[model samples]
Every structure is written in structure tokens, then in C-alpha cells.
Target chain A: MIIECRNLKKTYVADGQAVTAVDDVNLSIAAGDFAIILGHSGSGKTTLLSMIGGLTTPDSGEVLVNGIENWHQSDARLTEMRNQTIGFIFQFASLIPTLTALENILLPLSFGNRKAASSRQARDILAQVGLKDRENAFPAQLSGGQQRRIAIARAFINQPAIILADEPTGDLDEDTEQEILAVFHEYHRQGTTFVVVTHNVHLADSQESPRILHMRKGVLSEENPARTRAA
Target chain B: MQILARQINVLDYALSSLWRRRMKNLSVLLVFTAVIFLVASFQMTTGALTRTAERVLENAPQITLQRMSAGRQVDIPPEYAARLSSIYGISRIVPRVWGYYFDEVTGANLTVMGLATDRMPMGDQLHLALASGSFPGPGSRGSVVLGRAVNDMVQARGSHLLSLFRNDLSMASFEISGVFADATDILTRDLVVMNIDDARDLFRIRGDRATDLCVYVTNPNEINTIARKIADLLPDTRVVTRPQILKTYRVVFGWRSGFGSICLLTALTAFIILAWDKASGLSQEEKREIAILKVLGWQTADILAVRFWESLLVSGISFLVGVTLAFIHVAFFDAALFRPIMVGWSVIFPPFHLVPEMTAQVVLLIFCLSVLPYLAATVIPAWHTASVPADSALSGA
Candidate 1:
């Protein structure tokens, strides 16, 4: 298994009321799986993703990434995992404005936690994303699709084993969306595990997508056979 | 050396970055520069004055005779001179008569602080060749020597080093034949030197009493013995060391030391303000940058080195520039930043003679005592900035 979550729980006290975000959930993901975590607004899908990314901690139980417990590892080791093992493609607006396309792509590698070989890999990722000549242009100068491509380049800079993206194609036109999905399909073909959270129902129901889990009101539910729209 | 090289490289980058924001840093640098320069000048001036005192004291007469009367020094009885002349190891008993004489002709108040003796005409404080003309030889009596500064003041009245026969009431003309320079008094910069008898005749104490006896000891080591013996022999008189005699000029030296203190205090206050401004004016973005650097494996000491170099570069540049500018101000313009009392009194200090010692030790002290405390003071805020988490730092900026 690539990721193992055993009885993971996250709770928040908001307005003096105890709210369970991820309640005693257990899940496992294998390598080479392109999974979609489907959820409505306020369903804690992003929160679950954050815990899985080691950006935050679960209240109890274990998040073991290749048998290394995220809860027990030092913050430095956790950051290393984030830097080396997991790549996050944030929403459309997450690109840094002051950074050029190449600099933005190299941001994760610039953290002093990666090898020089990873910098070469970052350049390769930029070229693969079709931003070879646009490296010097800043985000404001780039089109939204191009900016997302540079962000994708940044995400894969360390050649992480898993890529987690939140709404990677939410703001793109149909053509640009298909181009981005093609890049995802290409990475999935290369056996990199992928998890995407999106409101695209068609994407959630794709036949090739693996193990799509739907969430509502901070709780995950198994889709019924009667509800066959989901893949 | 490599670490220092890298530090200098970083300093160069930081300096260039600061240069991009010149207007802000320039004002701070100017204020800092002015304060440091003024402080340095004040230190140099005080140092010069103390050295001046030391030089004069070091070269002054080792022995002096003073008469005590009602808590003020009075004239030693002239009869005591002959008696003092007979004291053992006393090579000379130079009876001196000096009093303020406002010359009616020159309209100048001449301070006759020291007098020419009977055999040795110019007293311990003088050399006759330094006079404009000539001093009388060993046998000359009733001939007086006049300092060029004094002769110029009095319009060259006397015809000899000592004049026993004629008396001129207006300029104290008493046969002053020679002219001298170098040794001087405040009131007698334009001086009239004369034989002790001529001064005695002018003061109308022909055989009664003279002021102080300028004694030259045969054995300097016997000064205490001689001074004690003289004090006992002339029970009515008191004795003082040469520096003590020089201390009478303390009104001048006191004013000097006091002025130096005030200027330095002003400079120090300005230094405090400069340090305060440097500390308080660092922006949140700059602090965040430091925080990020710290998170990226920069050691605490490396960050401190950055601050140290930053301050040193600012102060060091300002120091060089300020000192250069002040040297021009003093050297070319004949100006003391804070005018010396002699400076303001129309005595032209010799050109190119501002012998200020800017020693490495002093430079180190200026950095260690003044600028280092300031750099260390910055540690609290810089450390506070460095201690901030990278996430908050990145997010805030």
C-alpha cells in the first residue's frame, strides 16, 4: 500500500461546538492508482487531503506513508516527505506573482531539501508541461492555463511518488482542461499515484478513474450500485 | 576565509539591495555619519589638548618659587634673592618681577608673567634667538630682551635687552635690545622683556622685593631638597612644581576639556538616535526575509554576521567619508570643528598641524564600544525576527 490511514480522526471546536471533520476513517491506497475524492462544499475533503499531505495532523490514529508514521515523524522529516514524496498542485490562484515561470517551477527545489538532480527534473517537468520557452515570464504575464501548467511543473519538481491536486482544471476552458487531463493521464500511465478533488461530476464518473469516494457533511459514503453515474 | 568571502558576497548583495532603497538608508547613513564624525573630532581635539598640556608640562621648568600672602602668592622679598643666590646647588637665583602693564602707547595689556634674570636675561620660559633681534651676552646688565610678539605690540620702544638709564612709562620701555618668540603668555603675546632691575625700577622696588625667583637647580634630583631648603630659607614664601605653575593656565585648559565633553555628548546623543533609527526602521518584509533565511539552514551566527556586516559597512563607509571631509574642513579652511579657545582667539594653528592620532586601537574601540553595542542591541529584534516560523513569515509577506 502506498498510503495507510488507520482509524484517523480530526476534530474542530467551532463556536463552542465539537465538530468531527474526518471521523475514525480508515482507507488505503496502492501505487499507480489515479483516485478522485469527491465531496460537496464543507465536506472536509480538503481537510482530509491536508492531513494526508502532512500539512496538519489527525486527532488520533495513524497516517503511515510507506510505513513511516506521519504523526510520529519529526517536522523536518514531515517537510521532507512533503518536499520529496508528495506533490500538491494547488488551486488556480496559488502561483506566486513575483516569481517567473521557471522560478515558480523551481520553488520546491529551492527549499534546500532537494538534490541538484531534482533541479534538472524540474526543468524537464517544465518542458513536459510545454513551458520551455515561457520559463522567464512571470505569472501575471502568463495565461491562466499556462500559469496552471507552470504550477504543475512546480508540483512535479521533486518527482514525487504521489501528486495531490485540488481543482486543477476548475478555471480552464474546455480545450485547456483536456490538455491538463492529458498531462495527468500521461503521469498516471507512468505509474505515479494521483488524487484529485474536484466538482467535475463527469471526471468523478470516468471509467478509467480508480476508487472514487464521495463525501458529504464531513462524512464519506459508499456510492450505491443504483447510483451508477460514478465510476 | 571562504566563509568570510561568502559573507562579503552576501553583504554585497544586501548592500546593493539597500542601495535600491537609497533614500531611506541614505538619511539614516547621513545622520549616523554626522554623529560619528563629530564624536571622532571631539575625541581627537580633547586628545590633542591633553597632549599639548602634557608637552608643555613635560618641557616646563622642574622648579618654581611662589610667595604666599593671605592665600594669594605675593612677591618674594628681593633681599632673599641674594640670600637664595648663596643656597647650595642653586646655579642661579633669578629674581623676577612681573605685573600687568597697560601700555598707553600700544593700548595693549602686557602680562609680564616671567622676567629675564640679572646674568641670564631670558628666564626659564625663553630663548633669545627666537626674539627678532639679539639678546645681551653674559656681562650685560641693565639690558633687556623683548619678544618679537611683544615688540610688535609696543612699536619697538627699547634700544637694548636691558635699559637701566631711561624709563618710558607708556610701554614699559626699559632698554630691551633683543627680540624673542615661542614662549608666551595670554596678555604678553606682544611682550616686552627686560632685566630684573629695569622691572624693579619700573615697579619702583629698586632694592626692596621681586615677584618669584626663577631657580635653575644644579642637580635636578635635588629639587625636593632644594625646594625644601628654599621654602625653609624663605619662610615667608611657598614653592610649586612647573606643572602646578602651568596649572594656573587651567582656566584655558578647563574650558578646553569642558568644550570637548559637550561636543562629544552631543555626538554621543546623535549616535544613540542613529542606532535607534537603524533598529526601528527595518520593515516587516525584511524581517520575514531573515526568518526565511533562518529556516533555510542559515545558522543563528550567520544571520548575526549579516547584521554585523551591514552595520559595519554603513558605519565604515561613513567613517572614511566623514574623516576625510573633516580633515579637509580643518586642514584647508583653518577651522576646528569645535573651535579651540586659542583657535578662536586669532592664534593661527600651524597649517597641516592637526596632529590627531586615529589609532587602530581607537578605531576598534569606536566599533566595539559605540557601534557594537548598537549591533548587539539589534540582536533582540533580529533574533525575534529570525525565530518566526517560515509559514507565518511567507504567509505574512
Candidate 2:
């Protein structure tokens, strides 16, 4: 299993009330599997994806990436794991406004050891995302779809083993959504493991042979037993 | 090599980040620069004045003896030199005549000193350099050597001879024999030197009396002992050593500079408070930016590094600009803004160039005082922002 969560649970306190964001979730995904977590708003799908990406700590569970428990690693080691093994695409276009599109794409490479030949790879990815001409434009100058495409290009610049995306197509129009899904299909065909969390149920139908899981309140359940591949 | 590249990349990002908010950072830079300028100016002026005093006093007498009467300084009898001859390790003893002359014409006080005829070529003894003409000789009784400042005052009045009222209220005229060099202007600005006999006659002192007696010691280590002996022998006399005079000058200059720094403390405190407020209170946009960086796989250390670079660039540039301006202020403009306070008020102030003194220790002191505090003030806030979990911050939880 490339990723596994054992009895994951998370509770947040809001105005002196305990809200369990993710409760007792168990899951696993193989190296090249595409898993889509479907849920409505406030259903803990984002929290579960966050735990799997080592971004948020669970109150009572273990997240293992390549069999190494995420919480057991030092902060530096975990950060390195995040940098070299996984890529994250958030719901909003989380681009640094101060940086140009090319610089934004090159940011993840700054934290890793791959410096000598990464600029060419970044340019190649920018061209792949059809944003080769917008490389010098800052996030503020780029349209929302352009910025999202640049962010997706940034994620693929590192060519990580797993891509954790939360509502990757949440706020886009249908045409741009199909374009982004097409880009995802291209990467999926190249064998990149994906864990996408979204409130849109239609996203499950857009992927190829994807294992769809439904989340309600704070629990996760598989929707289609035939599509669930054993890790 | 990769680590260096990564740091360079992050520094580039830091620079761009600062430029992105250039207006906000520029205001902070201006205030920071101003505070540094105040501190560096005070330090440089004080250092230069102290150095000038030390250099001038290097040729001063090892011990000076003056008689006291009713808590006021009275002329010591020339016979006091004979008593000092009995002391061991005494190299030379000279009874000196010098006094202050109030000039009604310019409303300034002038220092008048009588030089012994035998000490003619006092170039070595007093570090005196003549800009023109010669020192007063044995027969030049009614002749005087004027310092640059005094000569300028006299020349401005369209005269070569300086006239002053003697002790009996009679006008005495003396020819201006020479002008002291500009290099010695700080020490000789209001000085007038004449033959000892002429000085005594003008001041109306008895032939047997002198204003003070200067005692030079052959071995410097025995100066204090000799001073103590002189004090004991002449119970009503004050014996001041060269070290004591130097120490007094240092204390005065140090106190004045410290006072200047203290006066500037309010501005410095306000700036620090402003910096602390700006750092501690991160805007929602900034907090979200930190979260985005964290999600992009930057560690807390890397985030801190970016913040560190931002601060270092601001402070380093301010420090350089401030110190450079201070050097120019002290060395070229004569610290005009601080001169009245640092050098004290005078009607006939000497115009001397200060050799700007900048040492590593001084640079380090300014850095520690100005830059370190700013950097420290930002650290906790930066760490607080960096340590937040990306998911929690992004979800606004």
C-alpha cells in the first residue's frame, strides 16, 4: 500500500463545542490507484484527505506513507516526504500573488534536491498545461482558470508519487472543468496515484475505474464494491 | 551545493516578497534608517572628539601644580619650581604663565599663554606648526603668535596688530608674529602666545609669581608618586596628573554622548513597538500566504528562513546607509546637527575636520543595538505563523 490510514479520528473545538471532523476512518490505496472521496460540505472528506497527506494530525490514528507512520517522523522528515512524495492542489487557486507563474511552478523544486535540471522540466510542464506563454504573468494577472492550470502544472513539476487534491474543480465552469479533468486523465494514464476529495458526486464518473467512497458526518464508506481494488 | 542553491532561491523569493509590499516596507525602512542615523551620528562625533583630545593631550605635562587660596586658584610663586627640583625622577620643571582674556569686540574669551624664550621652536613641545611667519624670539617682547581662529578675527578687523587692555586698563599693542597651522586649529583656535616677560607685564603679575608650574617626569610609572609628594610638600596646592586630565575629558565626552543616545531613546522605542506590532499582528491575507507556502511543501525552518532574509535585507541596507551618512556628517559636515551639544556652545568655535572613526566594534555595537532587536522582535511572530498546521489555517479552524 502506498498510503494507509488506521482508525483516524479528529475533533475540533468551536465555541466550547467538540466537533468531530473525521472519526475512526480506515483506508488504503495502492501505488497507481485513483480514489475519489465523495461527500457534501462539512462531511470530513477534506480532513481525511488532509490526514492522508500528512498536513493535519488526527487525534487518534496513524497515517502511513510507504509503510512509515507520518506522525512518527520528525518534522523535517515529514516535510521532505511531503515535498518529494506527494503533491497537493487545494480548492482555491492558492498561488503566491508575488510570484510569476513560472516561479510559482518552480517553488516546490526549491525545497528538494533536484535543482540542476528542474527549470526545463518546469517549462515542459507549463507547456503541457498550455500556459507556456503566461509563464511570466503573476497570479493577479492570470484568470482563475489560468491560475488553476498553473497550480496544477506546479503540482506535476515535482512528479510526486501521490497527488492529494481537495475540490480541484470546485469553482470552475463546465468547459474548464472538462479541460482540467482531461489534464487529470492524461496524468492518470501515466500512472500517478490520486486521492481527490470533493462535494461533487459527478467527479467519480469522470475518472477511469476509480474507487468511489462516500463520507457522511465523520465516517467513510465505499459506494461500489466492484470498483474497490484490494491493496 | 544544492543547499546553497535552495537558500539563494528562497532569498530571491524573499526579495520579491518584500518588493511586492514595497510601500509598507519602505515606511519601516525609513524609520529604521532614521533611528540608526541618530545613534551612529552620536557615536561617531563622540569618538572623533575623544580621539582629537587624546592626540592633543599626548604632549601635556605629566603633572601640574597650582596653589589654592579660599577655594580659588592663585598664582604659584616661581619658587615652587625650586621645591619640585628636590623630587626624584623629575625631568623638567617650568613655571607657566597663562590666563583668559575677555574680548569685548567679539564677545569671546581668548586663552593667552607666555612661552619661555628658550622654548622657541616649540614645534616639538606643543606640536605647534606655523602657517606663516616665526614664533616670538627673545627680543620680540611686544610680539605674539596668534592661532588660526584669532588671526582670522584680527584680519577681519583689517589690522596686523592685536590691541588689548592690560591689567591697569591701559591699551597694549602686540604685533602678530605668526599664525598657527590649520591642522592644530582644534587646540589653538582661541590661543595667543607671547614672550613670558610680556605676558607677565600685560597680566600685571609679580616677577616672582607664575600662574602654574608644570612638572615633567622622566619615568612615567613614578608620576603618581611625584604628584603625591608635590601635594604633601605644598599642602595648599592642587596637583593634577596627566592621566586624571585625560580621564576627565573621557568622562565628559562619554556622558554627553550617552545623554544624546538617551534623548533618542523615545524614537527608538516607538520604532520597536511599531515593528513588534506589525510582526505580531499578521493580517488574514498574510496568514493565508503562510498556509499556502506550507502546503507547497516548505518546512517551518524554510518559512523562518524567508522571514529572516526579509528582515536581514531591510536592516542591512538601513545600517549601511545610516552609517555612511553618519560618516559624511561627522567627517565632512563636522556633525553640524550635534556640534552645539557634543562640542558645547562657543562664539568662536574652531572648525576642524573630524577623522571619522569606524571600527568593527562600533559596527557590531550598532548592529546589536539596532538590527538585533528588530530581528528578535520578528522571530516569535514568524515562528507562530510558521508553526500553524496548513490544513487548520486553510480551513480557517
Candidate 3:
């Protein structure tokens, strides 16, 4: 398994109330599996994806990536996992406003202990995302669709084993959404695991014979009848 | 080495970030520079004044004797000079009569130095040089040599003669014989040099009484011993040594300097408070920026380095600009604004050029007092913001 979660739970205190975000969720994803987690607002979709990506630790469970328990590891080791093994695509405008599009794409490699330089990789990824002409443009200068393309390109910069995307198509038109899905399909063909969390039912239906799961009120359960794989 | 190279890239990013907000940062920079300029100018002026005082005292007498009767200074008798001349280490004893003469027109006290022409050095051997006219000769009745400032004052009053008033309501008029050159203006800015007979007659000194005695020691090594003997022998008088004079100057300058520092420190404390408030209250956009970086796999240390570079760039530039402006103001323009406050009695001000004496130690002190507080102001807030996890940091925004 490329990623595994056992009895994952997370509770947040909002206004002096303990609101359970993720409850006893167990999940296992193999390499090259493109999975979609379907949920509405306030459902545990983002929280579950964040746990598997090593961004947020579960309150009472273990998140293992390539056999290394991420939650119990030191902060440095967890950061190493996030840098080398996992990538994230947030829903909002997350590009650093001060940096150019190319610089934003190159930001991940600038942080991690990556001995090798990434100038060539940065160029190639910009070309792949069809943003070669807009590399020097700041995020504020770009269209919403263009910025999302750059965010997708940044997530692919480190070539991590898994990519966790939360509502990647939240701000795109139908055509731009299709274009982004096509780009993801192209990378999915290259055996990168993708765990996408979104509320768009069309996106969930578009996946051909996919391992689709439903999350509502902090509980996650499989929905695809054809895929009955157990954790 | 790789991390260092990557940090350089982060520094580049930080530079761009600062430039993006240059207008806002410019205000902070200006205030920071003002704080530095104030502190540096105060320090430089005091240093120059202290050094100038020491140099001025170099030409002063080895030992001075003043009569103190009933806790008030009285004129010493001329006979005391002959008594002090018999001391073992005393080579020469010069009895000098000088007193403050109030100029009613100018409303400033002018120092009237009585010169015994026959015993005084002449021409280039004399410390005070005549700019144009010659010094008043011994037989030149009712004539006085004036300093440049005094000459300008008397000329401004449309009079070529100086009207000096005495405490006993007696007035004397002296013809302006000559003016001293500007080179001696520092010590003689308000001086009026005249013959002893004219000074005695103008000030109503009867029967050969002098203001004080200037003792010249034969050997430099025996100066302290001679001073001790004079103190013991002249129990009714006060003996002031050169070292004692220097010490008094040090105390005066130190007290004024400490007071100035306290004022600057208060302003500095206010600046630190402003900086701390600005830094600690990170905008929502800035918080989101940090969050995005963490999501992009940036470590806590990397975020901190970015903040550190930002603070350092602002403070470092401010320090350089402020100190440079202060140097130009003090060494070139003579610290015109601060001179009035630091130096009281503005009419008798020293007119010498200040030689800036900036050492590495001074630079380090400036750095600590100016730069370090700013860094602390920003860094503590940065550490607090960076301590939050990326997931929650975004949620707050």
C-alpha cells in the first residue's frame, strides 16, 4: 500500500464544543490508484485527505506512508515525508503573491533537502502545464484558471508518490474543469496515486470504474460496489 | 551547502516581498533612521566636545590658585604671588586678573583678561593672534583687543568702543584696538584682552589685587607634588590642577551625555513598542502566505529564516543610512540643532570643527542599541506565528 490510515480520528474545539471531524476511519490506497472522496461542506473529506498527506496529525490513529508511520514521527521526519512522498493541492488561492508563477512552482524544492537542483524540472513542468508563457507573471496577474494550472504543476514538481487535492476544480468553468481533469489523467497514466476530495458529483461520476467513497458527518465508507478491497 | 544555497533563494524571495511593500516599509525605515540619527548625533557631539575640552586644557596653566573666603571666591593679593614663587618646584608665578564684564548692550558676559604686556609673549609667540589691527600696547591708554565674536557684536551695535559695566555701577569705555583671529575663537569667543592697568582701572581693583595666580612647574614629574604642597600651604585658597580640570569636564560631559541617552532610550522604547505591535499583528494575508509555504513543504526553520531576513534587511539599511546622515551633520554641519541643547550659553559656544571618532566598538554599540531591539521585536512574533501548524494557520485566515 502506498498510503494507509488506521482508526483515524480528529476532533476540533469550536466555540467550546468538541466537533468530531474524522471518526475511526480506516483507508488503504495502492500505488497508481486514482480515488475520489465525495462529500458536502463540513463533511470530513478535507480532514481525511490532510491526514493522509501528513499535513494534519490524527488525534488517535496512525497514518503510514510507505511503511513509515507519519503521525508518530518527528516533525522533521514528517516534513521529509511531505516533501519527498506527498503533495498537496489546496482549494483556495494559495500561490505566494510575491513570487512569480515559476518561482512558486520551484518553492517546494527550495525547502526540502533536495541535493539536486530543479531548474530543468521547473521548466519542463511549466511546459507540461501549458504555462510556459506565463512563468514570469505573478499570481495576481493570472486568471483563476491559469493560477489553478500553476497549482497543479507545483503539486507535480517533486514527483511524490501521492497527491492529495481538495476541490481542485472549485473555481473553474466546465471547460477548464475538463482540461484540468485531462491533465490529471495524463499524470495518472504515469502511476501517481491521487486522492481527490470534492463536492462535485460530476467529477465523482467521471471516474471510470473508480474506488469512490462517501464521507458524511465524519464517517467514511466505500460506495463503489465493484471495488470491495478491505484495509 | 545545499541548504545554504536554498536559503539564499529564500532571501531573494524575502527581498521581493519587502519590495512589494516598500511604501509601508519606507515609513518604518524613516522612523528607524531618525532614531539612529538622534542617538548617533548625541554620541558624536559629546565625544567631540570632550576631546576638544581636553585639547583646550593642554594650553592651560599647570596649577591655578584661587582665594576662597567664607565659601565665596575673592581676589587674591598680589603679594601671594611672591610667596608662591619661593616653592621648590615652582619655576614661575604669574598673577592674572580676569573677570566677567557684563555688556549692557549685548546682554552677554564678556571675559576681560588683563594682560601684563611687559611679561607676556609677543607676536607669533603669543597664543592669541591679531587678525588685522595690533594688540593694545602697554602705554596705549584705554585700548582693548577683542575676539571676533565680540568685535562683531560691538560693530553690530554701531560702536567701535566697548562699554563695560562693573558691579559697583562704574562704567569704562575702551577703544577697540584690534580683533583676535578666528583660529582662537573656540576659547576666546567672548574674550576682551586689555592691559593690566586699564583692566584694573575699569574694574575698580585697588592696590595690586589679582583674580588668581597661574603657577608654572619646572618639572612635569613634580606637578602633583607641587600641587599638593600648594593645597597645603594655601589653606585659604583653592588649587585647581590640570588633571582636576579635565576630570570636571569629564563629569559635566558624562552627565549631559547620560541624560541625552535616557531621552533617546525613551524614544527607542516607543519605537520598539511600535515595531512589536506591527510585527506581532501579522495581517491575514501574511498569515496565509506562511501557511501556503508550509503546505508547499517549507519547514518551520525556513519560515523563520524568511522573517529574520526581512527584519535584518530593514534594520541594517536603517542603521547605515542613519549613521551616515549623523556623521555628515556633526562633522560637517557642526550639529547646529543639537549644539544649542548640549551646549548651554550659546553665545560662548566653541567654534571648532568636530572630528568624528567612530570606532569598531562604537559601531557595535550602535548596532546593539538600534538593530538588536528591532530584531527582537520582529523575531518573537515570527516565531509565534511559525509555531502553528499549516493546517490550522490557514483555518484562522
Candidate 4:
């Protein structure tokens, strides 16, 4: 298993009241699985994904990513895990606005151990995303699709075993969404596991798209997920 | 790499984000600029006042002497002035030629403290540069070296001729010659210098009788002991040292030190409030930006370092602008406004022309006490808000 979570729970305090954001959630994603968690606004899809990404810790429960006990690790170690073993694609592209496309992709690489953060790995990764021509473009200069594409490139830039995408297609139109999904499919074929969160019912309905899955309002359901081929 | 990496690099990020909202940044910077200007002006004025006080305490008046009687007025015959030179510490004594002459042209009335020395160390301190007229040469008669301001005034009076009164009745005329500046005493510019014989003749003081004795001690500190001993030896007369003669000034500078404190305190309080406002008013979006930076693998130290850089940059700009503008403000503007604020006319010429001291230490201290506080003020807040719960922090934006 590239990603695993067991009995995850989160309670948020607001105005002196405790509200459960994620309650007793358990999930697992293996290599070669491309799954999407479907939910509406406030359905806790983002919260669940945030916990698996180690950006937040659950009030009670354990999460392991590639045999590493993530919840038990120090913040430094957890950050290292996120940087090297797991990739996070937030709902918004959230590409560092100040950095160029190439620099943003290479940002995660710089955070972990120094091997791929070096010049050689950065060059090869940017080339892999077919973004060599657009390396120097800032996010504002790029189209929404292009920015999302750069974000997709960043997710795989460090060669993380699992990519946790929280609505990677949220800001895109249908045609651009297809292009972004195509990029995710190409990386998934290379044996990368994906746990994507989205509210798009069409994406959830496509049995050909998601493999192992769960819905925040519903429950986990294993289906014949679409298998994509690398070009 | 450490030197180049930046003290607070995230400050650059903060500023860039602030820049996207440039109008807000400009308002903040404008208020900041006004505060810096006020601080620099105050500090420099205080420094100038301190220096002027130092200058006034340094030199003795040219023709210093004691009164023959303990009473305020001395009525001695002129003939005894030349013979008084036989006394120890008496380089020479000349008669008091005149009681006091009021020069209407210069607006001063001072008793002529007659001199017999050819050249004097007391005169050198007053010089804008050295002067080369006769040094009261061997019974030199009817010659005078004018103090810088008096010389200019006398020269300005036109027709080098000057009128002096004797016995408060007879008139004496003299020529204006050389002028001196860089004075050790402010009173030096107001006194008139004349030769021993001419003074004796003018005052009609004769023989071993002079109003008072003027002493030049080889060792300056021995003046007090020498004055006491001479007072014991010459029970009829008294000895006075130049330093002791000029004792009314110590209280003025005593007032200056207190004024400097007020200036520094005002500046310090203003600085702290400005910092508190800037640090406290940071919005949620700003916090989210910092949190994102933290989550993006920036260490807590790294995030803090960035704010430090931003603060430093702001301070550096303030110092440069503040000091430069202050220099111009003092140089062109009258320091009267500051004098009332720093020490308030306590008999010191409040400095209007200030040459800025831009040494590394001054710059560093300025930054440390003033700018560094503003810059470093943001650290704990930035760090605490940065290492926040991700969801709440993000939602703040």
C-alpha cells in the first residue's frame, strides 16, 4: 500500500463548540490505483485529504504512507515525507505566485533530501511534464489550464510514490479538465497511486476513471477504474 | 552564503504581497517616513546642543585677572602694574587702563583687562587660524588684537578709528586690526586688548599697585592651590585662575543631558507604537501566505528570517532618508524650533548646522534601537501565526 489511514478523526472548535470535520475515517490506496473522493461543499473531502497529506493531524487515528508512520513523525519528518514520498495538489493551483512554472515544480524537490532538488533532476522533471518551453512563465501569465498543467507537473516532479490531489480540476472547464486528467493518467500509468478529491459527479460516475474509491457523504466502493496508458 | 541569504527573507515575500496591494503599503510607508524624519531631527538636534556646550567650557578669556579688593570695584593707581610682574605665576601684570568702555557700535561695555605678554596660549584657542600681529613686543604700546566677532563689528563700523572712555569720562581711540574665531570663550569676542604701558598711562595706575594679579600656572590644576597660597602670601591682594573665573557655565550643559533623554524617549515610544500597529493589523490573508510558506517546507526559522529581512530593508531605507533629510532640515532650517525642544536656550548656541556622523556603529545603533525593533517586532507573531492549524489559518484568508 502506498497510502493508508485508519480510524481518522478531526474535531474543530468554533465559537466554543466542537464540530467533527472528519469522523472515524479509514482509507487505503495501493500502487497503480487512481481514485477520487466525491463530495459537495462542506462534506469533509478536503479535510480527509488534508490529513492524508500530513498537512493536518487527526484528533485520533494513524496514517501511514509507504510504510512510514506519518502521524507519529515529527513535523520535520512529516514534511520530509510529504516532500519526497507523497505529492499534494491543492484545490486551487496554489503554485507559488512569485515563482516561475519551472521553479514552482522544483520547489517540492528542494524541500526534501538534496538528490533530485539539484539541477539535473529539475531539468529532467520539467522535460517530463512537456513544459520545457513554458519553464520561465509565471502563473499569472499562463492560462488556467496551463497553470493547472504546471501544478500537475509539480505533483510528480519529485517522483513521489503517491499523488494526493484535492480537486485538481476544480478551476478548469471541461476540455482543460480532460487535459489535466490526461496528465494525471500518464503519471498514474507509471505506477503512481492517486487519491483525488472532487465534487464532479461525472468524474465519480466514470467507472473507467476511478479505481479504488470513497465518497465523503457515502462510503468506499471498489470498482473497475479506468486504466490509462502512458505516451 | 549566510551573509547573502538575508536576515528575513520572508519579509520580501510579505512586501511583494503587500505590493500587490500597493496603496496600503504606501500609506504605511508614508506614516513610517514621517516618524523617521521626526526621530532623526530630534536626535541630531540634541547631539548638536551637546557639542556646543562642550565648546563653550574649553577656553579661558584672553586678559583674565582678579580684583585688587574683595569688593566689586578696584581703585588702584597705575604706576604699580609693571612691578607686580615680580610675583610668581605672574607672567606680567598690566594696569587697568579703563574702568569700563561702552562701545555703542558693538553694544558691549567691559573693563579693559590690560596685558603685558608678547604672545599667549590663551589667545591661540580663539583663533579661526593663527594670527601674526605684534605680540605686545617689549613694552608694546597702543596695539590690540580684536576677537573675531568684535573685529568684524569694529571693522564694519567704518573708519578703523574707535573711541574708548576712561574714568568713565575721558575718551580713547584705537584702530581695528586682526580678527580671531574658533573661540574658547564667548566673552572673548566682547573684550578689548591693549598694551601694558598704554594701559598704565590710560588708567593712571602707577608703581607696584595694580587692581588685581593675573597668573599663568605651568601646571593647570595647581591653580587652586596656587590661588590659595598666593592669597595667604599677599594678604592685601587676591589671585584668580581663568578656569575658576569661568564657572557660571557648568549648569547649562547639566540641563542638556536631560534634554537628550527626552528626545530619545519620545523617539523610542513612537517607534514601539508604530511597530505594534504594523504587526497587529496583519490580516488573515497575510497569515495564510505565511502559513503556506511554512507548509511549503520553509522552516520556522526560515519564515522568521524573511520577516527580518523585510524589516531591515524598511529600516535601512528610513535611516538613509531620515538622516539625509534631517541633515538638510538642520542645515537650511533654523534650529530654534529644536532648541526649545532639546535644551531651551540654556546659554548654548543651539546648533543649526549638523554634519551627520554616519559611522558603522551609529548606523548599527540606529538600526538596532529604532529599525531593528520595528523589524524584529514581527517575528514571534509571524512564527506563531505561521505554525498554525492549517484549516483555520487558510480560512483566515
Per-residue C-alpha lDDT of model 1 across residues B51-123, encoded as one tens digit per residue = 4445535534466677887888776766767888768888776666767666555555554533554344234
Q: What is the C-alpha lDDT of each candidate?
A: 0.62, 0.83, 0.80, 0.60
lDDT of 3 by residue, A1-231 (tens): 988899999999999999999999998888888888889989988888888878787899988899889867888778777887877888765888878998888888876544565667877888877778889999999998888889888888898888888898988888878877877887888888889998887885555545788999999998854653321
Model 3, stretches more than 4 Å misplaced?
A112-124, A130-132, A204-209, A224-231, B67-82, B85-185, B188-212, B216-232, B235-238, B350-352, B359-361, B393-396
* Model 2 agreement with the true structure over A78-181: per-residue lDDT tens digits: 88888889888877778877889998888888767555547788888888877888889999998898888888888888888899988888777798788788
Task: Assess the local accuracy of residue A8 in candidate 1 as a C-alpha lDDT between 0 and 100.
Answer: 78
- List, residue by residue over B208-282, the lDDT tens digit for candidate 4: 455554445556656676667656655555455555535434345335535655676576667667677767677
TM-score of chain A of each: 0.87, 0.95, 0.92, 0.83
Alpha-carbon runs more than 4 Å astray in model 1? A1-231, B1-20, B68-312, B315-335, B340-353, B359-365, B393-397
* DockQ computed for model 1 against the true two-chain complex using alpha carbons: 0.10
Model 2: docking quality category = medium
Distance from true location, Cα of A227 in model 3, Å: 4.1
CAPRI-wise, candidate 1 is incorrect
Question: Tens digits of per-residue lDDT for model 1 on A1-231?
Answer: 898878878898999998888887676778987777787766777767767776657888788887889868876577667777887776543565655777667656544444455556766777787777887897889988888888777777666899888777777788777767777888887888987877677675433556677767667655553343234
| TM-score, chain B, each candidate | 0.68, 0.85, 0.73, 0.69
Model 1 lDDT at residue B216:
74
